[model samples]
Target: MKYKVCGRLGKNLKAGWLALVLSVLPAFVVADEPPEDPAHAHDPANVWFIGRGGQLYDSWMATTMAEKPWGNHPAYPAIGNKRGYPTWRCKECHGWDYKGKDGAYRYGAHRTDIKGVRGVLGMEPAEIQKIIMNETHAFTEDQLPHSAVEMLSYFLSFEQIDMDKYIDRRTKKALGDFDEGAHAYQSVCALCHGYDGKKINFASQKYPSYVGSVCARNPWQALHKIRYGQPGTGMVALSNVDLGIVVDILSYCQTLPEE
Candidate 1:
């Protein structure tokens, strides 16, 4: 899909802000310069996060679909209904699950016309971010603040994930050895998620089997949370954990009953 600016930053800005804007986007000239720094995870100008944020920004913001290129922009901004494209928020279309309607927002007005960013699994964070920042992608430099870019840096640098190797699509189980994953789960998740893998009650309306259910419905969602961590939840991303170990955990999760 062609990338177009849906919105621009507010006019009220200081010299630094204006400079940042210019540096982020120059008129007419499409420069494919790599990010300025690779080590700096907190700077938008950093190669790692900006690139990741760019992809993420694009995933939620840009439209490639020929049927609905706009991909259901929010007619109103308010959660229930306000004005000016309420659906513009990333959370609106993709749902908190990031698996799009296939996950949490499967039903409701927020239910939209596409899938989620979970397909980004296995891609390098920088590569993923590049897709987000591309003109035809979700985020435009003019549309977001430096902090937002930085936050994307944090996500791409620290949060975004790659799940392809971890899950077994055929058997719907994890594929790696489990020693480290066991240790991590016992240390961090056993109390709430439980040793039996049933504490989360994902099957019930009140609770769901975090592991079992996610694997059955969409393993990609599980992989994303494992990497980036869930928003507003106590769960944290496991960037330090080896992907092999994560696969072990998923393997175990696939063993659980769906109901």
Candidate 2:
């Protein structure tokens, strides 16, 4: 017997095929999405959330949408007030380098004579959480939610990098291949910071703080920003990039004009 194709049957078959394709499309789309970075896979929170914690470390008041701690930070008189708003920032006292008075802020205007967070580098996240809530830090749940606290704690516990490996403290320079860094900068950073590395002046035009300025003045801060990105900005973290490449990028950035 010869089989004939019916119009109605053909239409039904077509509809069935369309429905099948639609059902399986999502799986393919999800498969194409990038996987979480393994570097942070062991952390209590995802890298992005931990990055938010880093933002909190920079300015908890800004990150949590809470008021700044009232009055001098209690330690203010000893550390001085040259840093202004940063005087209230964790980075101000501990240093953006995360080494506190023992490192970057050891003798500068940011000097506080306080110990660095390095001592707690590998502490448990939960333990770090308690430290923040303690009388010294005095952060309450009302100001920083449990989630925020967790993220911050996780960051402090696991995210601090050793600056000595990537930066030379004596010269305040990146310890990487400048040529390689120049290429990386041209490929990825030039789009935003421009060839001169002055497309964005993070500080006022009068002082004109560019990528070069940041690298020259604080290679540690530049390295941190390069690794994790500037919080709450369009800045993309080079977390996936090799640390050596990042060091190279920093080295190139140091060549830019500071003023």
Predictions in order: lDDT: 0.51, 0.78
Q: What residue pairs are clashing in model 2?
A: none
Q: Name the top TM-score candidate.
A: 2
- Tens digits of per-residue lDDT, candidate 1, 38-128, equal 4554443443333334344333233221122333342322343313333555555555445564655556565654566666543455665
- In every candidate, how many clashes are there? 28, 0
Q: After superposition, how far is residue 129 of candidate 2 from its true place, in Å?
A: 0.7
Model 2: what TM-score? Answer: 0.77
Lowest-scoring 10 consecutive residues by lDDT in candidate 2? 30-39
